[model samples]
Target: MKIAIVGATGLVGREIIRICEELLPHEATYTLFASSNSAGTKLKVNEKVCEVKELKEENIETYDISLFSAGGERSKKFAKSFLNKGSYVVDNSSAFRMEEEVPLVVYGINEDKISKETKLISNPNCTTMGLVMVLKPLHEKYKLEKIVPTAYQAVSGSGRAAVESLKNEEKLGEELKPNYRDGFYTRPISRNVIPLAGNLTENGYSDEEMKFVNESRKILDIKSLIVEPSNARVGVETGHGVFCSATFQKEVDVKEAIDVLNSFNGVQYWEETLPTPLDAEGSNDVLVGRMRKGLSSNKILNFWSVSDNLLKGAALNAVQIASYIVQND
Candidate 1:
């Protein structure tokens, strides 16, 4: 099998290469693609050096699978072309996520949503990925009606430039000027938390916040589930943390909920210890903890979930989809 990773030099792209090297069969070969400026750069995959190529229309058909983390514009432009050439695409950007024909999938929660005929799959946003992992089991038993989630996301979610800005802040100070290449972020990301993530929509919710609502509903197959989300950027550099209060149609038993979480695939629950960014940074599993009854009502349950934004939240999930395709084939 041959795989092509677009945006090969980006943070998520690099992590995808590492995961592909670790999990994919050794017989598979990988090709890296980047912009013209980065095209000739060398990248190491599975300890083997490979030169990054400029993505072109002519070369997209050479791979069986393509993983895209090259921002939405690139994915919008190139993903369909790759799919048209018979290569399955797992896009990490928001490009095709809400498309009626595209299946927004999380490996354990909604792998069944993918079919032999499906060629393009969308990876959920980092915050949504961790949130739904914990919500899936509970929703199955209790039936979720509404959810209010507040995400404390990492700098890495923005891009390498944001990560560099945070590092520079540590060396300089919080007042450091915005140096992000694209000016993607509105404020400094170090020593403080920014309440706004992504652009604010006309309805007042930021794009990142709405992703939690829209993507969760799609992945859970719940069209009417009410989701109110507040997404924020924190000083942390790796994992994403989500705190949510979920209201159910029926009464929930905390013990049963804990049991359900423990039994769920791709999630781990702790009773005494709560998961943090430090605990989740290098791990593939979504670490869930602090499960209890919500303060407001008996029908509402509150919990915390954490996962490596780059791993379970992005690269690992995409690779898992690729692996599933290979296994099924």
Candidate 2:
């Protein structure tokens, strides 16, 4: 069998290559794809040095599975081409997510939504994936009425440019200064927190914030689920952290909530020390802690969670979808 990795030269794309080697079948061959600028570059995948090909229709070939993390626009343009050639496409972009027919999936949560006839699957936004892993089981125990999620997202979630911006600002000693303005982001990422994490929409929310709201509703199958999300880009390098307060129909039991979270497949509930972004780097599990009843009501529960944005959030989830297809096929 053959597999394709699109965006092989990118941040998440390179992680995907590393995971494909670790998780996929030993015999499955690898092909890497990138834009013209990265084309002809070499990357080692599955112990073989492969040339990164240009992502053009003329260069395409049929493969068993294709994993995409290029970007939304590129996925929209090229993903169907892979599907037409009979490859199962697991996309890590906003492209097909929210399409009425497309299945937006989180591996341990709503992955059962994928099926035999499924041609393309979507990985949720990095922060949303971490948020819902905590919410899904809690919702099962106590029907979730509303959610207020405040995110401290790592710069790595934005891309290599954002990460570089953080590093560059720190190196230039601009971040330590009172007034520092030059970076790829609107604000310097070092020694700072930027409230504007994405493009502003007419509704006064960011595209990233809206992704959290809408994607949560879709993944949980709750059309009217209330999600009040506020996101910020933090100086951290890898993990994304979310603090959530949820109101439910049933009163929350602190002990029971901890057990429920710990028992969940992809979640690790912490008791003594609250999990931090530093702890989540390179880990697959979403770390949850600071569980307690909300100040005002027993029906409300507040908790904090952290996860590696690149792994469980993006590349790893895409590869898991491919694994699910392979195992179930």
Candidate 3:
């Protein structure tokens, strides 16, 4: 299949190219798309070099599949333009997620929502993807009542600039520059933890936190499930960790919950084999372990979940969703 990756020079886009080269046996053609500023740049796929092109409505119509990882503004403007031209778009932005027509998909969770008529598919936020991979199976076993998740998100989740800023701050000392007002983050992201991501809505939740609440409900088909999310940026490089404490509607059997998590799709739990950033860095599966039930609360369960924010969190999930559509439809 011919694929065009919009924002192909960005971190997630680059990883998508690498994954396609590694996993796909078919000789697929890849067209890389970037903004006007990055149009002339060249990115390597396998040993071959492909020049990045500027996205145009006419050019976008040429590919069978288009993966969009550029921010919302670009997606909002050009996503439909590509789709209107008869291309399937698997977007990694929050732009069209809540739209009724667009399916917000995690490949193994709700991939069946995609159909031949579906042109635009939205991939959930990085944290939401990790949370749902662990929550979906558990939700099926015992209905969830509430979830309190506190995340130790890696710096890479912010974007390439934020990761570079952290590296630069380490060499130039931990002093905030007037010009460098945290371009992709809310506060000083070096040697410090930022308690928020995105803007605070009128309801007092940041856009990132609200994604966990709303997307989980939509994916799990469980609205009115109380989700309290506290998102923070840590100084790590890759892999996001979530410490989740969940309350179910009924008394959950501890062994049963563990068995369910062990059997869930998109989750890897080889306790002896460590699934860190080094292992899951470019893979599609979300790694979940350290699961335990709260002794005090019969309804509560505690666990930790982790995944490479660039892959399962963004590009790989988008690709898996596309693969599912192609196979099922």
lDDT tens string, model 1, 174-251? 446555333336666777788988889999999999898899999999999999889888989999999999999989
Q: Over the stretch 1-329, how does candidate 2's per-residue lDDT look in tens digits?
A: 89999999999999998888888898899889998999889898867889999999998899999999899988999999999999989999999898988899999888888886878888899999989999999999999889999999999998888888888888876426646777878777788888878889999999999999999999988888999999998888999999999999999999999999889998999888878999999898999998989999999999899999999999888888888888877
How well does candidate 2 score on lDDT at residue 6?
91
lDDT of all the models against the reference?
Answer: 0.89, 0.90, 0.81
Off by over 4 Å in 3: 23-25, 173-186, 270-283
The TM-score ranking, best first, is 2, 1, 3
lDDT of 3 by residue, 206-301 (tens): 888899899888888788899999887876677887889999988887678867877887787646665555566655678866777877798889
Reference-based TM-score, model 1: 0.95
Model 1: residues with Cα > 4 Å off, grouped in runs: 174-184
Instruction: Check candidate 2 and list the clashing pairs.
Output: none
TM-score of each: 0.95, 0.97, 0.91
Task: State, as a TM-score between 0 and 1, how close model 3 is to the true structure.
Answer: 0.91
- Please tell me which predicted candidate would have the highest TM-score against the true structure: 2
Q: List candidate 2 segments past 4 Å from native.
A: 174-179
lDDT of 3 at 89: 92
